[model samples]
Target: FDLWADAPEEATGHQPQHLPAPKLALPGHEESYNPPDEYLPDEKERKTFERTEPSERKQHWLPEKFAALRHVPAYEHFVRERFERCLDLYLAPRARKNRINIDPDSLVPQLPDPKDLEPYPTRTAVVYRGHTSRIRSFALDPTGQWMASGSDDKTARLWEVATGRCLAVWQLDDVVEHVAWNPSRDLSLLSAAAGHKVFLINPKQLWDTERQLNTQNLLSTGFAQAAAIASDEIMACRWDKPSGEQSSQGILAVLVHQRDVKQIAWHRKGDYFATIQPEEADAPVLIHQLAKQQTQRPFRRTKGVIQRVSFHPTKPLFFVATQRYVRIYNLQKQALVKALQSNVKWISSLDVHPQGDNLLVGSYDKRVCWFDLDLSTRPYRTLRYHRQAVRGVAYHQRYPLFASCGDDGSVHVFHGMVYNDLLQNPLIVPLQILRGHKIEESLGVLACQFHPSQPWLVSAGADATLRLWC
Candidate 1:
């Protein structure tokens, strides 16, 4: 009989599959029904062993000294352990990653180089140094040749931009809180806000004889109608003519408020202006018409503490910034248009774009936020380059430049290109950081503004100096 040939056809190269026995089933000293106490671990050692990973453990099972086999508990993880063993025997290990055939550099957006975007304020050109105390605010006239500044020294000084000469100075009874030049070139008028009043002063010497006469006549004609106007028609402020020494100093008329005026913003036409008395919660914002000599409270009750107010360049929109929000109101409709949430702790300054489609906000949280009005109410970009609180922010009227000044004693200039095509997002590139003023008494730059016609920037600092960056 050919036994080998008949049994499985005598497969010479093949051997029986050897399946290894499980470690758990294999008998060892740990599996002993009644192991010695010395062979077993104490409670602390067992806890340490339990905490150790299963793969890192010295043994697969713990040693237990039981009095009887009936006291032994069943192995809870026996089925799981056997299943894992079966998987290891059947399945093969694998490693894979999806590959992409694209260049890494192409993923980034293309932006214009800062060097290509010129005509921005790159260096300090002039420094006006007359204020005995910190300068609070300043403005450039429509011609861009003259500048007006309010200081804590209870004075407002006019300066010639090129020579840094103090052309004139008007002393007030209290610290000058704010100052702004009328946007009208036909009239050479300046507004100064001090304690409880706003002075409409015509610096007659700054302009020619004809222009000065026209400005004087325009301001004088308002007083003739002031007496005829009813008192109740005026909201929270009164238009009163300055007398005695005030008239000689070019003070044309004074708008007296119940509370101290903190800010003054003029409309593009120069006939209308607005003032904010933040202390008065009920009547904080007042709009005044120069020709009518009337003061009107636009809002019956302001929601929050007023920080700053601004006017749209070409629209009838008025921007009122509170602690953490900027509310826009339409003067014609007398209704709320949009409320911008700045996402900041406390807003220190607010400036609308010349195109009126964007907004710039500075906050005490050391952030400068840019908002595209067409986009979300949240900031389109939140920049935090300042080491201290941001005190001022401004946008150039005729340029694609924006600047922010902070308590860190630095002014960061950026090239903010707003594209006409709505599909293309605005490109912002940091240009320069101009630093010169020394920090004084926990404060640095307090206010900043751009020139009306030129790419010049003027910043008023708590160091009692105004720097012109061109």
Candidate 2:
């Protein structure tokens, strides 16, 4: 009796199964041949192959000699074995974890042409929880009512963005690295964990969402190797329509070895998605966005993946940040529009001002950096309020205000989103600091997001606490 299966498997002919290829190392970091560093003393990590003589390398005879061999079953088997290993890797993982649960209601609606985000800081809300432990990731629902979270606490929690109430607590019992809210159904969520399995959870459960996890009664199986590439991120999984279903349930995991996808972003509207996969050295950051379904596009490198992906509130421009640098890409043109920098430690998240020309970027080392999209000579103002890493940031939609939270376990509420060229207008003035508990937890703020129609905010932290501020 599989606890996660919806129906009795033997009755339905479904069998329990395992991931097709968790056997592979890191989600995307295995090589055809991995030799020990000691095997190559210089540590150059290079491989050498003898150049074969043309006479020896060339086949003694032409295709006519092999024609007779092609008809034999043995010849066919030999050809199949050549690429079997590569194909097996992708197929193995699917068999292990192929129970994809999708709610029929989770369908993309006909969309209006995208519009520019109106400028005007509208409302400001703050969230904080004074609990121990640190938060690792945050996810937002486009409508803003629900926020799904993953943390070092080995659990995934859901909260109402309007009021930070822990709507649901999913005890994963594994280090949940990423929690992605199904954009279509805020209650429908997906989380990737350390166990190498992607768990689909329903904030609304019981009857329909009861489909269990059974691989022996497998639906489909394929291998998905996990390799520890510097920027390969199995945790940063994405769902794309790709000419099929509009539901966020449809996904196509890109095959990128030796990289971790630290940051991910979806387009304002469409089946397009992008992830920042970085490799050691100067490996190009892969930017994958929607290019209409069926158009198999190549990778769009954004210089480096040290930074992350932040979509424009209403525009097509994308803002990616680093420890001390930022780059803006004109999505329509697929070109680099701006290169800006701030000698900051690490800008973890970027939230563009909903109404004004200002931008708020949170960092691990404290101060939240501020900048103007048009005037990119340098950061316009530095909001030096938080004393610890500020992992979550949100901009008000109508009022001239914004909010930030961090490991300090306090949500700093600021009243100004400055973009004045005269330097007369300050970016954000401290309006208030909201703390959920009198005691500060060891973990600071993990993630924060606001609902589209409410004057409130939702947040999660490593303390496994979720709070809503208004």
Candidate 3:
């Protein structure tokens, strides 16, 4: 109502408002048929017009003189002049805009120096050499005491992380594709993916009697129910107990898949684990529950070739990485949460940060992409320091560090500090490149992971060795 501004209209006189130039204006002497000599451009002025950019030029056309109106040449830019005139009449006048004089370097976020973020993996500390063939994958136990490695030599070996001593070896009939230690320290169990089957092994010799017994009961509790169910009921996988030599090798139960199992990812709780069979079109991914001995097909129909799978660190989210995209699914709601665009040709591996707010993706195109989950689906940073295909990537569980390894036989370590403030972005700094393994058959480092609790990294390579960097 009038009460709002009636007093201000008189007390504060109406502020003067600047109006734009009128759209219609009379042509000046430059457009006259018989213009003055001062209005015409000289030879030097014509040359300057030719050298200047079209957008920066003061006049669209040069002025010329004529003795008589009838003798004047037809306006060469007549059509262009008409079009510009029409545009001015129809469009609103634009205000003059001044460019921001910002320094390119000043726009960049300030990050701490790499030297200040010390204790990252710097030099090779130990090399565990026992695998006869290239190591496909390896994982460290939650306690950081032991390491399990799978290789093409059809063997899975356990090694003491500190001493690099091979404690035990379990021989298989085919190449071991992947291996992972159960996240739960009480279970002390290891899962290894081989040709068409995933073996659950509990090396009782390395664990105490109570832990061994607990693992056995958990694995064997569902045996009766699994046997009662028909094979047709669970078309994805079958849980069966190994016998004789395989049983003596500490193989608890073998999960038979329709095709070769390429990757295995254990849930944070250790009872449920997911396996990937790239060649299996119908059921490429299967989630298995240890206590119930149940295998579930997460997707009825799959998209691109499944490269790898990872479980969220603290949530009921599942991360499935295809050739070019990483999709996160909500297990409880059975809905898609987000599809992270890696923008890489072929994703080789994936790892979620321990905090579960960030993702790291390695690609065969020699690129490493980092994604902040809270930010957007696109990668926050894309790094291209690898000379060859990036085979593996990992984040330190305790330290603010991440590393990527490739066929160049070098591991590039980076200091990735994620700030607690949501407004503040992550600071990434290149720390060091640890190179020791010799390139063999064009394949260098196959996999890399950090110690669970320490500032150490263990890398498995095609050189048939695992190097420790601290």
Candidate 4:
């Protein structure tokens, strides 16, 4: 009865009181379920697990709860090993992190560097001394081994380019105004303009002394065999004359104007040539085809006093230079394609680049302008280094070089690069100034040309000498 009475206090529906919910263990309570040192993870393992675990999971489990879980000795080692694996995955070195090496000097050899160009015509290697009168025109043979020059001496002379030795000379009836070597590698022919007639000279016949002597004897003996042989050797004695002219004289071709033909440019294929007359403002520019020996007027009438004409290196186009402007005509379309504007009052000469995308123009204002046909009708660069008017300009086919001669008695060499991309600007570097020919009175260097394949140049001047610069 008494025991039941003592438990009477719990007889109520509620259980005994929880001792005020067992107040939280005091900071230094020893009997309050303390974890063993080995059972709890070390400071290093705890920090690693904190760093490697996701942020949301870290907020869900308190640091005390993690410590309580690691309180199990077996579980503490497993937790530490998991943290170590995560560290190795993120902090370890990778194979793809290797460094790379590069070299800067590996550029294509075909492309020329502007810094390597030397712009001085310092070497006067040889002086060709055959022409007695002022040499007006000069041309390099296809092989680049020989040069042909025409002068006021009424003769066209061929000389060895390397030695300046005169190989042969052909006497003409009038002053040799212009000369051009056949561009064909298979043919050794030359064309010379004098007075109203053009002569097609065969170098083979001129080189054969026996043939010349026999021809002379036959002419003297009045034999038909000699005349037939002379006719065959000379090819066509005279170029086809205009329809109005009746006589078939012993001449290769006839100029539209009775005055001297100032300039002649051969087509790239050596099939035709163009001629211009300085005095004939009313006459049209004449184009003579070799196969037909016929002349056709490309321009029905002259635009202005035509100074020079040049055929495009690879296109069906020709350029005409007048006193004030340069015009490009399309041969196939038979129309004016472009008219290049110029600030200079007079344009003396122009030469087209082999790429057929640019032109080099020389003018009387002492300016040498480089015109980019694809960019605009205006000169891309106007260089005024020459003291006097520029007389002639020539471009090298295989090299990124060009030459200009002027009345100041100087020849300037420049490196011009026409890049493949339209966005890239052309590189023009003035490399050298060649000065050897003396300026006689007002006349200076009349013409200049580059050897086809060699690093040689030939300049004709009023001094009656053709100087070779290498």
Among the numbered candidates, top TM-score falls to 1
lDDT per residue (tens digit) for residues 255-320 in model 2 = 332344454455544234444545533333434322211222223343444656667757778777
Tell me each candidate's RMSD, in Å, in order.
9.8, 33.7, 9.1, 22.6
Candidate with more favorable, higher TM-score: 3 or 4: 3
lDDT of 4: 0.73
Give per-model TM-scores: 0.82, 0.53, 0.78, 0.66
All models: lDDT?
0.88, 0.53, 0.90, 0.73
Candidate 4 lDDT tens digits, 1-470:
67655565556547743332223335332222344445445689667767775644432221232245445343334576568667766676444334666455554235455457753345898988978889989888788877889999898888888888887777777888888876866555577888767666546533546633442332234322222333322332233332322122212233334456777788878768877766754453677666545556566577677888988887898898888789998999988999999778888888899899999988988998899999999989999999998989999887888989998899999888789999987888777888999989798999999888876778999999999888
Residues 61-167 of candidate 1: C-alpha lDDT, one tens digit per residue: 87777778798889887898879778866684533445989988799877777778887888889999999999998988888888899999999999999999998
| Native-to-model Cα distance after best TM-score fit, residue 219 in candidate 1, in Å | 1.6
Off by over 4 Å in 4: 1-115, 118-121, 205-257
Worst 10-residue lDDT window, candidate 2: 212-221
What's model 3's lDDT at 153? 97
User: What local lDDT score does residue 39 receive in model 4, on the 0 to 100 scale?
Assistant: 46
Give stretches of model 2 more than 4 Å off: 1-134, 160-174, 182-259, 279-305, 417-427, 437-442
**2 or 3, greater by lDDT:** 3
Number of colliding residue pairs in model 1: 0
